[model samples]
Target chain A: METQLQLLNTQGFKHTIRRLCYELIENHNTFENSIIIGLQPRGVYLSSRIVKELKEITGLSNLVNGKLDTTFYRDDFRRRSNPLIPNQTEIDFIIEDKKVILIDDVLYTGRTIRAGLDAMQAFGRPKKVELLVLIDRRYSRHLPIQPDYVGRVVDTITSDSIKVKWDEIDGQDEVLMFTDNVEKI
Target chain B: MSALSVRHLLGIKEIQASDIDLIFSTANTFKEVINRPIKKTPSLRDTTIANLFFENSTRTKLSFELAEKRLSADVINFAASSSSVSKGETLTDTVNNILAMKVDMVVMRHPYAGAAKFLSRQVKATIINAGDGAHEHPTQALLDAFSIHEKLGSIKGCNIAIIGDILHSRVALSNIFCLQKLGANVMVCGPPTLLPKYINELGVRVETNLKKALEWCDVANMLRIQLERQDIKYFPSLREYIMLYGLNMPMLESLKKEILIMHPGPINRGVEITSEVADSHQSIILNQVENGVAVRMAVMYLLAGAKQ
Candidate 1:
């Protein structure tokens, strides 16, 4: 058996997201030259939501956004038991010299962000790049990555896992924390 | 996290439908990767692949090499003609000698069928059968199916016709198995002599008339006649073969409906398919070649992570 906790409910989740959007606008100003790039799989959900919220706030319809998958760029390719399946990276517009914001649902070990930075080099050299996450697992980073805009911060041990559920995908918007069985971990 | 069911990609017949789906889905991601400006991934940075061609090849060898390089895998090329195989070194000994260099995978093309399978049994490295005799060219079939699926949205319920040299072409055998597994109706069109004796046993329709096959299929994959592999005369003359089995622009224009044209390539030019037809907008031969790298990359990527 495992212990579980509900960190944020639907109302709190909505308020948190709106707060993050306002923080983004504060930093990005008009976001005219800035683009939002969501990491693949889970990240796309949060990033898409953020993109929509940003558009609603700024009234800018042409804010560029794309999804990037880091499976090929991941450092742990063959380290795990099962093979890593890659998702589609669908960035149609040019990212050269543009300020890019990378978004994910949860920032855990920070390795994904490192991989995303490497993967972004393939598109073109961005003028600047920043990281944003709905939940940041503080002190659990394996790499030197810090999020520019964070919704919530929770200090976690190695065995603790965090999951962000969205209404669009998981039937509800909530943040859950699970303390896994030590042996299983 | 999904991996390939088999350690080696020996043949299309050896893999399941789910494996094909896995390869195609993985290839979808790789296709996008290759189209990028950088066009290189570091997934296989620590791995080394050995390209062992015991038979003559131009496209398959180069394509495998390019795929390996694009994946950032250290690659070494070996031809049987230049290697110690000509000096009577056994298959086991030659591969073992290369495996001694710590090669993680082997992409092989040999004159005998099941050579890749035999190598997998004899060695400890992942094996990819580029082409083994007239048996299976798994990657070629995969890329052909992928190109068709790309153009038509889905391969299921699509009419795909494999034409020419069915008996001596590995591409035809693999294509038949792959297309059938993907729910595509397959019809093999070739001369009576060129068609295999047990082709009907595989459950694919056999047609001797090219026009009938073309009219029936949504896509026609034109195969090259293997003149080099013909120990005895399969057809009387090239001119006669062209009249009966060749794909020409005039023949294509005669069809009431437009059909997609494809070739495994190293084309015989006017012999199997004319330059006009090969270079036409309907022909996806070049796209097939481009998809070959991505499909091969996907195969290598998946197999590289397979449980040992």
Candidate 2:
């Protein structure tokens, strides 16, 4: 059986989110030209929390927030057995000449971020694109992608998995890392 | 959850109910994407697809090519008339040559039944059956069901009547399979000779009277009479068939309820359905055509994504 290693509990997760929110406000002080896009599935949960915190701090009610699904753009689609389940992408406004902040829960292989870059092209060309994540698995990069804003960075090997659990979706806020020797079955 | 169980989409018979639901859900996203200002995505940029059409098709050919381009896959078009298949090249050899060029998938429309299925076995590339003679056209049926689900809110329990040319139509066969699988009540309406043998065994009601069929169905899918596929006239005459089976304004109004009209085009305007009904507000033929691209995109995306 695999033993769970808790990297961040409820308090730590909340503190990290608040810190990320403040850092976002420091760089993106105004909401006129900036849009926040969360990568679909888990990324949307974390991004929404940050967006909620930003709204509470800055009193900006109209900060453009959308979800981007990268299922169709993944490189490892052919290697998987299950048919890809696609999530909804709801971007009501245009992204032309706008700053795009892409938010996700964890950054490991950097393949999801690359796919996000490709999916973003379907909307409009952004003036600038930036990546944000709660957990950055250090030294495990498959693509040359680095996050602009990171909450925590941890060193991990290829056989490890980092899982982020949210309170809204997962019934609790916690980050866990699992070693691959213990089978998930 | 995966969208499909099978690697290649050869027919509706090979697909499960959940697979159709997944395809529809994926197509819903593509539908939104196609309506945007920047419609193209770089999702399949690294993949390559080939359109190998052994039979003549204007809409399916163009629709598949457009879907491929929208997904950003490298696309090549090959028709039998211009290819080495005309010079006595075998189907396997022709497809193998295309596969040799690093083609990852093929959307084929052939004149023989089970052609796409046969090609799927001979080659490793994913195969999407555009149309294979009188066998199946899975994507067309998907788009048809999708259009219905879009208009009617859901396909389950909806009364759908497929009218005309059941014997020689792959669309009719595929649609019957798809609709039944999705919990829709299906009825096949055509002339006695035009109706297929053992169609009742497929668990669909068969009706020869056009008026009764129209009165019973919530949606009427009028199929075009396939002049190309007909070796001999199945019915007595075109005029007689139109008088008995043709859908027009007066007949539609006689139904007393707003029944949705659909057709897998190119429509024989005055034959299976009149221009008035085809152009009416109830007609979702154009929406069916629009959904074609989205459905094809979903199928190609799923197949390519499941390549391993």
Off by over 4 Å in 2: A81-83, A179-185
Native-to-model Cα distance after best TM-score fit, residue B265 in candidate 2, in Å? 0.6
For residues A1-185, what per-residue lDDT tens digits would candidate 2 score against the true structure? 45668889999999999999998888888878999999999899988998999999899999999999988777777677665667889898889899999999999999999999988887889999999999999898999999999999988887778899988878999999887555431
Q: For candidate 2, what's the TM-score of chain A, rounded to 2 decimals?
A: 0.94
Candidate 1 regions with alpha-carbon error over 4 angstroms: A180-185
Best of the candidates, TM-score: 1
Global lDDT of each candidate = 0.92, 0.92
Per-prediction DockQ = 0.71, 0.52
Model 2, A86: alpha-carbon shift in Å?
A: 3.0
lDDT of 1 by residue, A1-185 (tens): 67788889999999999999999899889888899999999999998998898889889998899999999999888888778999999998779999999999899899999999999999888999999999999999888899999999987888788889989878999999898544433
Give TM per candidate. 0.97, 0.92
Worst 10 residues of 1 chain B by lDDT: B299-308
User: How many angstroms is residue B303 displaced in model 2 relative to the true structure, after the best TM-score fit?
Assistant: 1.7
